[model samples]
Target: MEQNNMQDLLKRYLEGNCTPEERAQVELWYELLDSKKAAANEAELEEDLAEVRTRLAMPFRKKGKLFRYPAVAAAAAVLLIISIGSYFYFNNKPSGVPQKANKLLATDIAPGRNIAILQLGDGTEIALDDQSNGAIAKSGSNTIYKNAKGQLTYVATESKEDETDNPVSNSLRTPRGGQFQLTLPDGSQVWLNAASQLTYKISKTSRERLVELKGEAYFEVAKDANRPFKVLSKGQVVEVLGTHFNVSSYDDDPSVKTTLAEGAVRIVETGGHRNVVLEPGQQATLDSSNRLSVAQVDVSDAIAWKNGKLNFNQSDIYAVARQLSRWYNVDVVFKGRAANVRLSGEVYRNTNASKVLEILAFYNLNCKIETNNGVKRIVIE
Candidate 1:
């Protein structure tokens, strides 16, 4: 590789585009410099690392904060990260860092922000992040707005004519590392979590206000005695008149969880006769094997994501890894025998990936950050 292209190579390595040999060369280069006090240009290496971090938009490690971990997998007492001066190396490079760590090496994934996509009734898509705080579209008798608080709201206006029959639908979708809030035509409020979608009927002629949920969402439904609000998720229909609840039915999850916070809700099986009526502080779970069960639970843990926190209360490492993966938009891979670990902690959703990994390290699990084609992955050993 040309001397000048080292920057390019580093970027390729960070972006997961580098070949195996190229990656090894980069790590070998790190090994050569970790302790080598060769009188070469120290300024050049510093500039290269800084430029790579900037190009990849990685968060810089704090200058003096030390990452402490106990003996973990025979690697306990390993100091994972030192102040922003530790050298970056490849897999299984070493057990410890040198005297001074390198400044700004590329590898932290940022947390998700307020982001979502809105599909208009006619099929026009609007990226919520790109639009300003104003009316974004008109749906029948309602005007949609990206409000000042960044919520997609449907405000009812005087109707000139009817736009109904099959229910004119508008949808909101949040990609990985994204979330959004919106109000429906029926005055219901919804908080769409990361990698989730909510499609609500905008037409007022329907006798029942209906919406389809794919991933997960928190609903604060508006009470309408005449029109019962129904959410059609995978295998179940959550019917509510006026209540607050959460439904998690992601494809990756092993079950569909419907947690009720306030009021009451009835969970009806899509094609079966199984049903359960839930009261406050109750949870109804529909498992993969088509089993329906209800239990008393703490509802806060269910809506923690909506309130800007990662609550891993009574969660195993795999569950924690999945939450981290969705929030940080990273894939998680276990390299060796996976740890039999369950954890309980609350971390704000606004922090970067390193902060959460540091929490994992505290529990003695080895976590590493890797990248491929602009996506970050959390690798555990």
Candidate 2:
């Protein structure tokens, strides 16, 4: 594979002075060189390669000093090698390749649109929409308000005599593509991601800090050794005390993923398993294997959706496609054997999905997008 040996092989093959097997070896090396050069200018490289192939096919001419100009040919050979190298790198690399960048897709769910609702204890409903900044209403002694970012904040009125009321729950609901943050009556903070819901009561009067979650949410539980914070997701229960963690138990997704960012959490399954403890940077999953699996992961990426970005260090095409479908509300299909395609990189949640697909196509992995029955579907080209 040295440069000199490669050049000698090419020269011999072009001169039609090598055996059939030797000629094949030279042709393979030339193809590899062509690919390397193509990374910069694919279209132009294709043209040059075609012309060089024609010249190479013709019988070699004997000029005294012509072979001295191997530099020109060497440059071309390296370019081809790089291009082919890129192809193999992408195709044969391990899963979760970072080359397939993330893109924002068109959705039944659009970005930056606010759609959240609040329900009070006595069954009173507040639209939360069209509510001006600052105080919106009062529930008992607490004043409900909206901040500049449209998050709901509750301020309890000061009174000379303290009296605690029975625990009554209020719920925060976020529609698809919507997210909002709130501090519960108990001073515990909850960040609700798209299409998620959390129900909690005010802190002091409540016996313990408890919240029920559907979909995804990041919790920063207030430390109350006497009153443990419990998060109920589906039939699973996660108990924590003054810790930071993210839970993704969306019914639409196959598994319930609980990633611990700080402190510790005890996850309880429905089938009478005592508890599974998670450490920081650890993820516990209730996968299709009917077993709970735990592993160390990049905690930041596991919770990136809360920050309005899709961060993929090395993700497979299928996983990326599934994320796009959920975020953009699209369906994806594959026409070719794209099983080995891996992608990397990050993208904003607000960009168009088509642009991302086009970039992938540039890498020789083609994709076609179509609209069907008012739904968008993408197929591998």
Q: Which candidate tops TM-score?
A: 1
Q: Estimated TM-score per prediction?
A: 0.72, 0.64
lDDT of 1: 0.71
Please give the lDDT score at residue 325 for candidate 1. 79
Candidate 1 residue-pair clash tally: 6
Clashes per candidate (backbone, < 3 Å):
6, 30
**Candidate 2: lDDT over CA atoms?**
0.65
What's the TM for model 2?
0.64
Candidate 1 lDDT for residue 7:
37
Per-candidate Cα lDDT values, in order, are 0.71, 0.65
Candidate 2's C-alpha runs over 4 A off are 1-112, 159-164, 288-290, 313-318, 329-343, 358-381
Candidate 1 — which residues are off by over 4 angstroms? 1-106, 159-166, 372-374
